[model samples]
Target: MTETHEIGMVYLAASDLELADAADDVRGLPVVTQLGHRLGEVEDLIIDPVERRARLLSVVSGGILGLGVTERLVPVEAITRVDDRVHVDRPEPAGDGDGRHRGDPADLAEEGYQPELVDRPPFAEVYERYGVMPFWTAGYVVPYFLRR
Candidate 1:
């Protein structure tokens, strides 16, 4: 049996838990911006145990042999579609083409920085960055794509 450990909101990695359907697993899929920019790959799913659904996607990018990889939590509501790649409706960073807009989660990860995942503060920041409602907030709903 998979063991789940709860923190503040009880977010756990989907890799350590059970997926309702194996085919629905998107752990290895590439995450792309709406403009077709490659952000990263889905490292894991952060699920809310109370809701029994995915709330965030642990996206990993920019690392050599897993040494300097950066992981960022993305709200599942940011996902626009899912096929071979997980497409997100995220805006491109506005800058001098360095792709480093201040406070942007994708840009932050590209800079090889991993955000803290076990806290509500970071979770709130991610949800705000993605312009999505937090799972803990009122009127927040899981995306239809993840409903299965």
Candidate 2:
């Protein structure tokens, strides 16, 4: 089942749904920027239940034993290739002193939070960073890779 957010979009954690094709599953795959900088590994997908496609990649990085880990959401449009690793078209953000990017922490969702509770600001930043049109916009097409 999908939950609709205040933004009027229906999103669900892919972990809660089964994929029609197991081979297309991207969870657990490492994510890299265009320069091959390791960003993190995909922990789950934020999928649009109404569209039946993935919208965002929930990537987890920088933590030991799950402590202090950061989760960032990347719009699917940022994905350039998907094979051994998920390659994004953007470059890594410059780091802050703490080894995390400045402003990056603002993108994080609360742990165990429902997808329907996701806010818009972080998603806006993600789409801007990736230069991808938001799915809600007219003329936005589901990326070919995510169609399956």
Tell me the whole-model lDDT of each prediction, alpha carbons only.
0.62, 0.65
What TM-score does each of the candidates earn? Answer: 0.68, 0.70
Q: After superposition, how far is residue 136 of candidate 2 from its true place, in Å?
A: 1.4
Off by over 4 Å in 1: 1-16, 20-24, 92-121
TM-score quality measure for candidate 1: 0.68
Model 2 spans with C-alpha error above 4 angstroms: 1-16, 20-24, 93-122
Top model by TM-score, which number? 2
Query: What tens-digit string does per-residue lDDT give for candidate 1 at 1-148?
Result: 1222333333344234555545556888999999998888886676755545666776777765445555566777888889999888977333222111134546445753433433233456566777777767788676755764
Clashes of each: 0, 0
Give the total clashing residue pairs for model 1.
0
Q: Pairs clashing in candidate 2?
A: none
